[model samples]
Every structure is written in structure tokens, then in C-alpha cells.
Target: MIEEPKSLRIGPDVGRRPSVEQVAAFQGVPTGFVVDAMFGVGAMCVDISPLDTSNVQVAGPALTAENRPSDILATLGCLRYLKAGDVLIGSAQGWQGCAAAGDRVAGMAKNAGAVAFVTDGPMRDYDGILEVGLPCWCTGLNPGSPFGTGPGQVGTRVMVGGQPVETGDMIVADRDGVVVVPFAKIDDVAARLGAIQDMELELDAEVRKGLVLPDPIAALLDSDKTEVM
Candidate 1:
């Protein structure tokens, strides 16, 4: 029997990264609280909400004793394209492979290279993952992650779980967590997001100083009867 592909599809190198502003504008907190320090394994997504999930897709790397995708190798290869402070914010598919522990991948990532790893699944090697100083982002910790058919195919748009990830994409990660951008839209998005972030920081400073505003946002918050948090 012939296997059919999933309706949602993406190709590698489509060229675009979600701008910080774009993602921030559409950001929503996950239904279940995600741990600040998770194993960094499951998958990656725009939001846990039903409306915000579909953003990027990632096909995980295939692994085995002899054919495992090396975190060190991928980091070395990715470094040529990424800066020392750059981030890798796509989804992972290792959860599909239950044979090996998540630590193996985390170790690879921690010791491998790049800023850090991000996923929506479980993660292992908490000690090693943290020790490496590769700040990670993930949903939860899965003891083991499964494998996929193969590795990145040069810009193939594969959904790590809910989010979409393409090859050669720019990623932004910080205390709030990780964000992935498509290669095509990095400049425009980054520039815009910079502005938004600055504005927010400015507002945050004022709020800290007891600045009060009956602005539209305040009205909405005052009127809202229900809150998720």
C-alpha cells in the first residue's frame, strides 16, 4: 500500500523566519504550564492554543548506533550559517525514537554546538543540558524521543509538532523562550520586533515606576472577566 502524506506540508528553504514582533503579536501561553527548565525534547510550536499552533514544521533526524544524526556534526554545520549568539528554534522529532534516551540528544546539543536546542517534547540529561550552558526551550521532558525518516533536506518545511521549521532559518531565544524565523523574512521581522521589544521595555520601565494608563489595553484587561493564568 502506498502511504499518503499529511495534508499540512512545507518544503525546505522556503526562505522566511517569523519576526519577533509577529510571533509576539500572536503569542499565547500554553494551556498547561511549561517548565522553565524542561528536558527540551517534545516539539516546538507558535502556541499551545488551537488557533496558534500551525507555524513551522520540522522533520527530525534519523538515529541509530551507526547512522545517528550527530548533534556535534549538525552544530558544526549550522554554525557556518548562525552567529555565536544566534538560536536554533525549530521542533525536534527524536521523541519518535524510544530506543535511546533524550540525554543523548541533549548531550549532543550541549556539547555539539550552537546556542541551544528547542523542542516541544520531553528531554533528558538535565544536568548535562544545563551544565553545557546551552539554554534550552521545550514543552516537557520525555525520557526518550523517537526518530524520523531523515535529516533536514535543505529548507524543507517540516512541522516539529505544531510549529514549522525550515532550513537556514534565524532563531531568537531569551528568557521568554525561543522563537524561530523563516529565512526569507528575517530582516523585516527582526527590525520590526526590535521596535516592539523596545517599546515594551520602555512601558515596562514606566510600569515599574508606577506609571498608570487607562489605555485601550487597560480597558480590555479591566473588562475581561476570565483569565487563563
Candidate 2:
């Protein structure tokens, strides 16, 4: 038979986090722009959304945790690893029957310097979480409580919302959804963000000026490649 495992596993702290200046670059930036910078990727699954629209936009380094279904030991353990401006991410293997976190947990995260909380599983105590003032994103809410059991890991990589997120990765989220910018790609994504923002602004202006069909689509319709049927 297998031996008993440790009640909780906490990995080493993230050795490299983006500079405050780099993290600030994403503050208040729309999730769409971040996704565009990542070549139309990096978005979390559509189901995970903000607990409230009041505090939707958030950007910070990720502090990741992974827990078994209907359990929250890993999430609780991650608090010790959280740094100021960190975004706490908990992966519950997509379990929705029980909440991965609740109001008290949100309060703890906020006190621990976490700017936001995100999980692939549902949460509880919606009103209390909002009052705690920690921005949160999850699949939904469930009154069911989770156990503080073992078989969980903290301060390591975790898969949240179908995306592989690790400590030190940048997490940018808003009312739209959450997006992850891998730690290795932070500078690269930042470099490309300006160009994407410029292009988006230009397109928005054109659309506001009563432009209907885009140039590419119109050209395709008028060219020999098109056939009327």
C-alpha cells in the first residue's frame, strides 16, 4: 500500500517576479488587449468570471495553488507565499460541487497582500467576498463547503481555467475574463502591447466614422475569388 503523504506541500517562493514598473504596465488594461498581444490566446475559459463588476480590472503576479476536488488546503497554504500585489490562483480540478473559497478566505488573501483571487472551481459567500474588497473570479457560487484536506500543493504551477499558470506569471483580469502572460513572455508581450493598442484604437476610430465592411472582406467579395451562388 502507498504510504501516507504530507498534509500540505509548499514549494519554494517565486525567485523572479516582474518589476513593479512592468506589472504596472497592465494596470487597467482591458483583457482583450492583453489577449491580442498574446496572439489571440492566454484567455481563461469563459465560465470563470468576476464575483462582482465593482472591482473587475486587476493585474499582478500569480501565486498558484492546486487542490483536490472539494478541498482547499492548498489554497489556504498559499497565503504564506503571497506577496504584495500578487494574484492568488487556485485550481480545483474544475470541481463545482463545493466552493474552493469563501468570504473568510478572501479576507485572508487581501490581508496577505493579494490583490485578487481566481479559481477554476466555484466559491461561496458572495456578499462577504465583495465586502472584503478582494477582486475574485470563479466559475460560480455554491453553499457547499470544502474540507481542509491534504494532497495539495502551494507556490507551484497549477492549471487554472485550462491554462498552465505558475508562480511569477503575470495575471491580468477584468470583467471579460482572466488572462495569463507566462513569466518568460512578460517582456515580449509588453513590447507587442503598444502596437496592438495603437491598431485597436485606429480600428475603433474607423468604426465610429461609419465604416461598414472591412477593407479585406470587401476586397474578397469584389475579387475573382468570389462566386455568387
Candidate 3:
């Protein structure tokens, strides 16, 4: 039997990932409530944007269909922290039988009540796992896994969907995209992200109104513009 490598082993914070958990715990939330609490709201584009899960469908003799899933243990270690309205998308990573591992994780998310898994890669196993009813996103499908890396330290920071994921991190996904939220300094970072979003939004509105926000950035305009200059 091949022994699991310690280089990228799963730890205790499987359910909420890692960074997400810290944000949730920091915010004094129930962890499960991070979603409703506005966790995954704005992190859409960066989500599946980094993924590529394409050939995830299967074809029978006459009927062709997509393969979905629900493999719980492969997802959250205990799943006690999962709740409804949660989304768990897969991120792309190079590993042995990697697609299958991601598929298994996606299945687990659905079974544990997460909304979906956004993988940039594909899975080899399908058909049987489609009933979990969870959504998935990726580039193509393959039935292999490298499995040497992912989040190593439970409850620590790692990337998912091109964004950092935490244990209590809020995940929101749709056809539009996926996102990980409630950054570190939960109560503070979340507000900061919100402010940034607002600033961007206001900028967009200003552009439409023919009123651009003042460019506060000053450029050093000469080859000798260094501080010494």
C-alpha cells in the first residue's frame, strides 16, 4: 500500500478549509453561518478563473450526461461544521490521480450540504456520483491524482479558486464565478474588502457620470526621479 505523504496531508480543518475558519472564528461566528453573514459575496471572478474542470461529463450508449458527486469524508474531515447554502469549489493543483481526488472532495462537499466545488481540472470517475446535486466548475476531466499538496496545516491559509481559503472562510459560487471571503482580521478585513468593493463601485459610477475619482497617485516622471534626485 502506498503510504500518504506528510508533505500535503489533510488535518482537522477539512470542513471549512483553513483561512476561512480563522476568519469565521475571528468574527465570533458559528462558522456555519459565515455564508449568510456575507462571507462569499464579492470573490467571484477569481474563483473558477484559476480552474479548468472541463470533461466532467459521461456518455452512455444512447444518453450522455454530466457526472456530479457527494463524497463526504474526502471533503470535510468531520463535516460537523457544514451547513446549508455553503459552496465548496475545487481549485486546480498538479498531483497523482488529482482529478479523482478533486471529484471525491466535490462529492463530499455536496453530501455535507455545500453548494458546489469549482475545480479547474477534471475527474475520471463520474455517473455514480452525479446524484449529490452539487454543482462543479473546471476545465476538463481526467481520472488521475498527484495528491502531494493542498492545505497542509489545518485552519491555516491556502488558495482555492485563485483566492486564499480559510477554515471559516465563506464560499459563494454560481455560473458567474466563485470566491473565498472574510479575509484575516475578519471583522476588520471583511469591512476593508467591502470598502474596496464600494470604492470600485463608486469609481465605476463616477466613470459613467463623466467624473473620474481624482488620481491621487503621483508618478516619478524622470530617469533621475529617485529619492536622491
Q: How many residue pairs clash in each candidate at the backbone level?
A: 47, 0, 44
Better structure of 2 and 3 per TM-score: 2
Candidate 1, number of clashes? 47
Model 1 vs truth, CA RMSD: 10.8
Quick one: ranking by TM-score, best first?
A: 2, 1, 3
Q: Which stretches of candidate 3 lie over 4 Å from their true place?
A: 1-73, 76-81, 89-93, 96-98, 101-108, 119-121, 124-133, 137-139, 143-164, 172-184, 211-214, 217-229
Model 3 lowest lDDT segment of ten: 58-67
Query: Per-residue CA lDDT of candidate 1, range 111-192, in tens?
Result: 4444455554445666655555555565554445454433333234545545465555544444434444455554454355
lDDT for each residue of candidate 3 in 140-215, tens digit (9 for 90 to 100): 4565543433223333444543455555555444434544454333555444444455666787787898973455
- The runs of at least 3 residues in candidate 1 whose Cα sits more than 4 Å from the true structure, single-residue gaps closed, are 1-101, 110-112, 145-155, 215-229
Instruction: Decide which is better by TM-score, 1 or 3.
Output: 1
* lDDT (C-alpha) at residue 183 in model 2: 91
lDDT of each: 0.41, 0.91, 0.41
**Which lDDT value does model 3 have at 226?**
43
